[model samples]
Target: MRFLVTGTAGFIGFHLAQRLLREGHQVVGIDNFSTYYDPQLKEDRNTILETYPAFSVERLSLENAPALNAAWKRHQPDVVVHLAAQAGVRYSIEHPQAYISSNIVGTFNVLEAARQHGVKHLLAASTSSAYGANLEMPFRETDKAVHPMTLYAATKSATELMAHSYAHLFGVPTTFFRFFTVYGPWGRPDMALFKFANAMLKDDPIEVYGEGRMSRDFTYVDDLVEAITRLVLVIPSERPPVEGDTLSPVAPFRLVNIGGGKPSPLMDYIEELEKALGKPAIKTFLPMQDGDVPNTTASPALLQRLTGYKPETPIGVGVPAFVDWFRQRYDL
Candidate 1:
């Protein structure tokens, strides 16, 4: 199948595109290489993918409607996976407009391209943060995601709504998966795992938010990609009510949670990193920042029911894998 994936330079995007290419699929990737984290890292990821004959990349942002439409018309992709976005919970509090432009406007452009191309399956990335301000233990796809604590989450929720509208009005089949805390080798520098790993290697103090009380279901990147690959074929066809399905009543759209299904404490994650690096981090406890949630756990029932798989890599193993990569990458 021919796949056009946005954010191919990003962590999950890179991994997903590689996985597809390894499975012998032709992939056309698009990324603006934003300075959100580091363009060097994005370039390095693209370099690796460019080595594959089946993979090709275009340098452009999704906000560029003409460019995006041109790429869509050229590739005529069988599937479109929209993963590019201004991603950061805390960063969203400082720069709300970035979230609007990238998450909102960027997603809008992707929807328009997909609608025009009449793609078979459109899979977009959402976040567990969409379940904001809800004290629920394990979030389900059908749960209310109306109360987003952060602008980033709000934009993602808005994208889901916007995609639903497009799917209903234009008959575009869409699947939006809400991700928990995703981490692994080639992870984003802005995420807690990368920040903690960098600080620990330098013997610097790691900022423990929520006084080390926060928790998250840290889904490994490879596992998330596997779920995504499987979901590519599980496209929604109609609005038939199925058990554990979040299928929209009016469109060929559904929501699934891609997570580990096991929420780990912030302190526990830190300890795992310490173990991985063979060094303890100087910890600085701080109150929770704005637009941050204390804990997030995914039910994963819908994902399992749909894909027959769930993320199972625990922190103990995943953290060490990332530490190894960090050490090799930085010559630590």
Candidate 2:
């Protein structure tokens, strides 16, 4: 299959593209290489992807509709995985417009391109943060996600609606997977695991958010990529609706949560990092920051029904893998 994947330089995008390439698929990657983090990291990831003859990338942003459409026309991919976006809950508070442009407008452009090209399936990334203000233990795909605490979440939720509209009106088969706290080797530096590991290695005190009360359903990157790979074939209109399915009645659209349905405490994750680094983190416990949630646990039922797999990597194993990669990447 020929896939047009956005954000191929990003953490999850890099992992997903590599997996597809290994399976002998042709991937046409698109990334602007935003400086939201170290561009060096993005360059490094793209470097590895470039080594695969089946992979090719265009340095452009989704905000640039003309460039994006031209690339889509050139590649004419069978599947389109839209993953690029301005990410970060707290960062959205400071720069809400970035989320508006990249998350909302960027996704809009991708949907337009996919609809125009009549792609076989359009898969995009959403976040568990979309399940805002819901006190449910394990978030199901059918849950009402209207109460977004952050602009970031709001934009992602809006993306879901936009895709649904495209699916309904244009008859585009679309699937948006809401990701949990994803972490692993070559993970984003801005994410919690990377920050904690970097601080611990530097002998700096790690700030424990929510006063260590928060917990997350952390899904390893490989598990997430595996689920996504399997989901590419499970188009919304093709599959019979399973129990707890979020498939839209009117549109060929569905939302699946890629998680283990397991919520581990924040402290437990930190402890795993400590074990990986073989050093106790100097702790600075702090209250929960604004736009932060206390916990997130995905149901994972629909994902398992659709793909017969769910993320099961525990922090103990995942944290160690990340630490090893971190050490090797930085020569620590």
Reference-based lDDT, each prediction = 0.92, 0.94
TM-score each candidate.
0.98, 0.99
Measured over all alpha carbons after superposition, the RMSD of each candidate to the real structure, in angstroms, is: 1.1, 0.6
Q: Which stretches of candidate 1 lie over 4 Å from their true place?
A: 238-241
Report residue 95 deviation for candidate 1 (angstroms): 1.3
Q: How far in Å is the alpha carbon of 64 misplaced in model 1?
A: 0.6
Q: Look at candidate 1 and tell me the lDDT of residue 66.
A: 98
> Residue 77 in model 1: shift from native, Å?
0.5
Tens digits of per-residue lDDT for model 2, 16-106: 9999999999999999999999999999999999999999999998999999999999999999999999989999999999999999999
lDDT of 1 by residue, 269-290 (tens): 9999998888889999999988
